[model samples]
Target: MTSAPLEPFAVTIDFATGALVPDPDVLDRRLADLDGYFVADIDDPGVGAYTVHEVRVPPTGNNLLSSTTVLAPGKVGDEYFFTKGHFHAIRDRAEIYLTLSGEGLLVMALEDGRTVTKEMRPGIANYVPGHWAHRSVNTGTTPLVFYAVYIGDAGYDYATIAERGFPVIVVEGEEGPEVRPNPRYVAS
Candidate 1:
């Protein structure tokens, strides 16, 4: 199967409702469920609350040029499925998340214990600065999906978050999922 430069591709509906909403058995990337995540609530670690399908590029010296990540929707107990947030290993490298469809929030935290949350919707772009740790949640009934572009060399450092999780976690709100301080964490 010889391919050409800038080959046109398509995005299919792979998942929704926390299930593997496969794309009619088409497309070429492997659908994988992320492993080893930190559950905000220790008692109920609802595994596989969400899934991810990504198109990753190989290393190109300094960094990979671009990549795409599509996250499926689900939840752990009352909390929504969210990306295990992280700060870039390189520290100075920032990232952008452009919402392609659905709805949710881009929750961020400053090192000084301050936190911020922004709504995500189609046609909106969230600029994540270097110092904050960022994560995305699926607040909509449908699969909350988005496309992301980031530096190739900017690897993910999930340990800092793994050890000292995010300051707040989004849980089922009466109106929708709302942000609440993580009880497991004691601010110091």
Candidate 2:
């Protein structure tokens, strides 16, 4: 027997507050949760870091999944607060991030050592192509919020990134946010 077709539906999202009307499954990443992901150790482990609230559909075919990431503004040492970056498990899946509020940097890097950084602000949509591991960095004094859409089946490969760090890092500089080499990076 075959299963019934899924019905279409709409979910309301408040751009200003980054809230979904029906509520969403939330994954809160606290300072303690990101053990080795940062350059320095936090004095307190319970500090609020970032949150990802998403509405997920079935992980089949071309169905799309959407989520909002709110990264709290702070730092460990001089490095800014950032999401735990990941590449799609499928390796060829792409994603897009539309900045809703605050300021941030979309930092992406390839396995071959190529890296790119894009400024994210309200009204800007950054397209992340396939095979690049992408991380979001909040460079402002307020929360950095962005809406992201990706294929449902584009599973995340966070382990690879945890094992091999990104080639570049973002840090506070006298001029502004500066991009520098990640000395801890190991080749895959």
Candidate 3:
């Protein structure tokens, strides 16, 4: 018996030569439409100070451009799944977290499940591997805001992670809420 030929993964595209690259203009239009669709709470309960805005391109093949705006945790009382915990992924790449406002804890989960939580303030930045499971929490009375930029695919495979719910470790409790991956995170 013979097996069928495997399909090659078309992840990267050539732009200088005008290959099968994603259209930038098309992506800009989509991002503009998503200016303020969803928002998340940081840690404050008084107001919805901390929020995440999605600026992502399509998640089809690969080569993705995306960003998220994390507002300072405020008085918003909405239940955000990862408010007390963190999350991660399966692919390998580079990620940057740049603080935009206030202060908080930046939690990164190790391969063994143990987490390395860091104190972050405005103007501070941190970098980690793409596959590392991680999350941010507002530890201060003020909201902690930042931007997480991922330089990889925008497939959003983890968008359904919250819907499926995963067991998580968190501060202030032994058990935490089930978290789904962000929709803006394009899964490779």
What local lDDT does model 3 show for residue 161?
A: 33
lDDT of 1 by residue, 1-188 (tens): 24344544544433222222333321221112323343433343433444344444443334434433454566656777777778888776778887777789999987666899999888789998877788898787776766666777777788887767789989887897889988765464
Best first by lDDT, ranked: 2, 1, 3
Please provide, for model 3 over 43-142, each residue's C-alpha lDDT reduced to its tens digit, 9 standing for 90 to 100: 4233333344444444323444444444343222332223322233335665678776666666665444444666667668888666555566655555
Worst 10 residues of 2 by lDDT: 1-10
Candidate order (TM-score): 2, 1, 3
lDDT score, residue 30, model 3? 21
Worst 10 residues of 1 by lDDT: 25-34
Identify the leading candidate in terms of lDDT. Answer: 2
lDDT of the candidates, in the order given = 0.65, 0.89, 0.44
Better of 1 and 3 by lDDT: 1
Give the TM-score of each candidate: 0.71, 0.96, 0.49
Which candidate leads the pack in TM-score? 2
